[model samples]
Target: MEVDTLRLGFIGFGEAASRFAQDLSQAGLRHIVAYSPSAAKAVLDDAIRKKADDAGVELLKTPKAVCERAQLIVALPPGSKALAVLRRVRPHLRPHHVYIDASTSSVKDMEQAAHMLDGVAPFVDAAVMDPVPINGIKVLTVASGSHAEQFRAALEPYGMNIQVVGEKPGAASAMKLLRSVCMKGLAALLFESLEAAQRYGIADVLAADMARFINGRPFEQIMKRFVCGTAIHSERRIHEVSESLALLKSLGASTRMTRAIRETLQQITDMGLREHFGAREPETIAPVLDAIIDAKRAQRT
Candidate 1:
């Protein structure tokens, strides 16, 4: 379908959906419909209603109404409500309809959604990788499922960056969850460190040092040095983390991340990483990871 002639529907009208609706409308998608439960209450002052109005989106009373009016349906509800939303809209689904679930749900939930939509409509498990309020439809979205490419083909013409990463359902969600482990953990660690630094009147100095260290070298080299060094020096790191935790405590800053660092280093030291490496840092991170995995498996047994 041509961009101007394509009809799009959203199951929710939150920040992400609002941005998408407005952008897609500006991109020549003339028919945009949405069904946000909150849009029905006190229409004059409702934030969702105002968003829909600003986006030129036709706010419908129900999900079924959205499905009936548009063939390309995008679900943008919370992760926990993904399945419930699917179940509510399932009866209105048609084989020709393309259903895109863009919620930050689990792999299992995405797979279950695919199963529920099996033979009813083409399901696209889409993981929005960026903040929609900042990028709108230009946000990088990784999609996976049997019909992910089809979804990409449909939306890419209208300026949506939907990359098809796999043919299996939930593959995109898996990537998002795995990425969150690093991204969210890094955010937590930075938060804790910056809080302590701010209390110590060294926030600017610490931020500059972190930027210099991170931007000075290729990330792969940095990661390898840290991973390998951790294997060899986990014992010493535990002491350092304890001291850092004590400093943070003295400054009345949170010590959760510091405590986690100490516990993780303690766990690695207890796993015999120091003895395994024999005072020499491993050349690569693979052996350190393998040793940790082996130790974990041994413990499981």
Candidate 2:
């Protein structure tokens, strides 16, 4: 179907979907419809409603109208609510309808969503790879499922960068979650470090150290130092983390994260990590993490 004349529908017109629709409007794709599920209408502020109206997007009253009217549908429901939204629209879905779910959700959830529409409509698992608008509506997407290629073709003309990862429904979701774990963990670690440093009047020092660690030293070199050096420095690191926590406590800052870091080092030290790694610095973390796993298994036994 030619995108310019197609009646594209959005199941949830949240930030990302709204941006995509606005981009569609800018690109002269006129026939766009959206249903802000009544359940979600309460949370959507006036600005979002204004944007939708300004974009000339026909805001429908029910999910059924979106499902029955549009040939192509993009589901952008909240991660937790995606399943229920899908179930609501399931009765309205037809074989001609193509549904691409762009919700931030688990692999299991996406797979089950695909199962829900198994023979009814084409389902594409679409994982939005970047923050929308910051990347624009052209944000990269990793998609998977039997209809992934079709989904890619349908959206690519409108400035979307959709890379089809696999023919299985869960692959895109898995890729998204794998990246999330590492990226969000690093973000949390930095937030904790910066918050404590700010409280202790060492924000500049922490920021400078971070820049040096990221730009001056290669990331692999830093990883090797931290993972292997844990054998030697976990005790020193624990001491350092404790001192940092103490300072944060004195400054009336939250010590939860600082204490967690100390506990991690404490675990490494109590497990006799140094003995497990020996005198030489290892290039890999497999053995180091395995040693901890072995210790945990022994405890369980």
Candidate 3:
């Protein structure tokens, strides 16, 4: 699978797409094109251009142009806008072209997109397993569809660690959705417990016990930080938990924990903490939370 000769296109040149383009370019995989919505296109174009210039890649104007320029298309648009992008690009998709959807969309949406792309191109639903910010270009991905192998080959050149989950179009999405339930659910739980513990002056003890229970696991530590961070970024955390709930429903599983997570997030939102927490680094959140808790306790006393 010689990826150098194959042109790669990106729909939605946002954070993820920019990272993908930059990483692929650094890996010496050229022939990249990208498109975003009309309003955001210019902004994204400039950012992507800087990235492309540094990595030596190309930036396209329209989604259709991207499709025309690349045999392998990676759709990194938001989950809500994924179907719209597909519909817009469907007319330009050609036979033998492969569409890899790396967005966090619903299983039904992925299946629908796959059906819409049938014959015109092979559609593979790819679930990105880690945050691209930390993983860079070598992100772990699980893809499923009739053309999984071909999609994997195309992405491999970009240093993708891809696994073919199954032949069903939505199988990979199902796995990602289910995994989000556990990953984000844990985050939500930690947030709620730590917030309550802080108010009651038990936060330090709770953190110590948590460390012992999890045997000081790196992910556990990360979750602790995520919890404190969510006190400020509750909105985004809420959205992820909402998506995780949808994923649970799609899998015929109960949404008990997810429902609880939403409630916890709402509590944080009601407190107007999203603005304060959203942009703050995880490392800087604990002291801010501790101060707020102390003030609240003093008022009550």
**Which candidate achieves the best TM-score against the true structure?**
1
lDDT (Cα, tens digit) per residue for candidate 1, span 234-262: 88888778899999999999999888888
- Quantify all predictions' global Cα lDDT against the true fold: 0.90, 0.84, 0.78
For candidate 2, write residues 99-213 as lDDT tens digits: 8888988999999999999999999898999999797677888999998998787777877789999999989989999988778878887887788788778899989988986
TM-score ranking from best candidate downward: 1, 2, 3
Given candidate 1, what's the lDDT at residue 194?
Answer: 98
* Native-referenced Cα lDDT, model 3: 0.78
lDDT of 3 at 210: 89
State TM-scores per candidate: 0.82, 0.71, 0.68
Q: Name the regions of candidate 1 deviating beyond 4 angstroms.
A: 1-6, 38-56, 218-220, 249-253, 272-291
Cα error, candidate 3, residue 143 (Å): 1.0
Best by lDDT: 1
Number of clashing pairs, model 2? Answer: 0
Off by over 4 Å in 3: 38-45, 216-301
Write down the TM-score for model 2. Answer: 0.71
TM-score of 1: 0.82
